[model samples]
Target: MKILAFSDLHRDKDAAWSLRDAARAADVVIGAGDFGTRGEGLADTFDILRDITVPVLVVAGNHDNLAEMQAANRGWPHLHVLHGSGVAIGDTAFFGLGYEIPATNEASWNQRLSEAEAEELLAACPDKAVLVTHSPPYGVADLQRNGRHEGSRAIRAAIERHQPQLVLCGHIHHAWGTKGAIGHSEVHNLGPAAHWFEI
Candidate 1:
């Protein structure tokens, strides 16, 4: 299937418009996270999300509250909000998580993911499924000032323990356009912007 993935949009509705254009030619469109102004912008984001003509899946960023996202997606068939949840897209299963660990330079939205939460989510995912998240796994797509890497150790452990087909994430804008690997799974960082690719 063809899927268009993007992240860290920061409330740029034009980017949403551009994504809609990409959705015209793809089977699915996914918004990784940071879709709002510090997670408070879901109200506006929902309107744009509803306009997508194709199936769309979304994950909350540190900026987003799980309850708020759920309420926004209520009764929406085409829009899906996954928080430690999974969805099947054709032959692939997509698993998603929303939060990242706190970094020295980067700020976190709320509580970071604990080992237990990571493991639970990983265990819930289908074998060899596609993983979707708001943060990158450690030493993979993560980067630091002076080029150091700062991804999530818990996330890395989950990928190592449960090798999925593909992992998609965003949060660190610099990570955009970068790809990495964990076990047999390929991980992508869509950054705070939008982009498209074929699955």
Candidate 2:
């Protein structure tokens, strides 16, 4: 399968437009999140991306409002706003967990989930399903500008237990475009750029 993934667009129209063009060639598109800042204007980015006819998977980031994001593309047949849910396309299964896992002090509007909450949500993920999350798993692709690892231990445990083929995530801007690993799973901290993968 051909997968095109990007994250942290943060309402960049040019980036969204570029991804629209790139999506033409992808069988599936993944938007890891933070389409807008502070829960505002996320619909603007989703508007451009919704044009793609392929299966487009999205998750809410710390800066996003899931209800707003879902409302934006309410009945779009190709768009799937996944949070604590899973979807299957062809033979591949995908499970997604949105928000800042382990919590954050960024802003009042920050969407967050405690480690236990995340664990409960992630426990339902099927083995080998593609794991899509807003925050990277602890100790992998999650280093901050201050050299701190601001990731979720629950996410890490999920990777260790399920070993998803690919784990896609974003949120830590400084770690964007970086890569890491957990067991056999590949993890990418994608930024607002077209990242292509074949599985």
Candidate 3:
């Protein structure tokens, strides 16, 4: 399947709209998160993404509220908000976890989780499935401006244990567009720009 993936939009309506054509060309659309600013305007982002006809899978970012995003798009078809869950589209299984580690950062909309919690949530993911997360795995595409790696240890553990085929994430803007490997899985920190991948 051809997947058009993007992340950390942060309420960029123009950039969101620009993804329509790419979405049309892709089999699936995956959004890592940060659709809104400080948990507001997610509906507006959804409105723009509504142009895509294919399945759209998303995870809430540090700037978003997962419950609010789901509530705001309650009636919207083709958009699936995933958190500690798996959704099957065609023959592929997609699993996701949102937000940053609580110990790393704090924000009103940031759905923070502990390392153990993240590992427990990811434990349910099936092997070879697509892992979508708002935070990158530890030491992989998670470098900050100060050169510190801000990533989830649990996420990295899960990747090492489960060996998912692909991992998509976006939180560390400085690390955007970067790719790394964990075990045999490929991990990408997709920025606001759309990235194309075939699986």
> Please, what are the lDDT tens digits per residue for candidate 2 over residues 1-199?
9999999999999999999999999999999989989888887788888899999999999889999878766667898888999999999999999999988766888999999999999999999999999999999999999999998999999999999999999999999999999999999999999999999
Better of 1 and 3 by lDDT: 3
| Cα deviation of 75, candidate 1, in Å | 4.9
Indicate the residue-level lDDT of 175 in model 1: 67
Question: lDDT per prediction?
Answer: 0.75, 0.93, 0.89
Q: What is residue 36's positional error in candidate 3, in angstroms? A: 0.5
lDDT of 3 by residue, 1-199 (tens): 9999999998898889888767889999999999988878887678888878799999999888788878755666888998899899999999999987635666555568898888889889999999999999999999999999999999998899989999999999999999999989999999999899999
- What lDDT, from 0 to 1, does candidate 2 have? 0.93
TM-score of 3: 0.96
Which regions of candidate 1 fall more than 4 Å away from where they truly are? 102-111
| TM-score-sorted candidate list, best first | 2, 3, 1
lDDT of 1 by residue, 1-119 (tens): 88788887777777777776667787888888777765477666567667676778888877777787777666567788887788887777888887655433354455256656666
TM-score of every prediction relative to native: 0.88, 0.97, 0.96
Instruction: Tell me the deviation in Å of residue 11 in model 1.
Output: 0.9
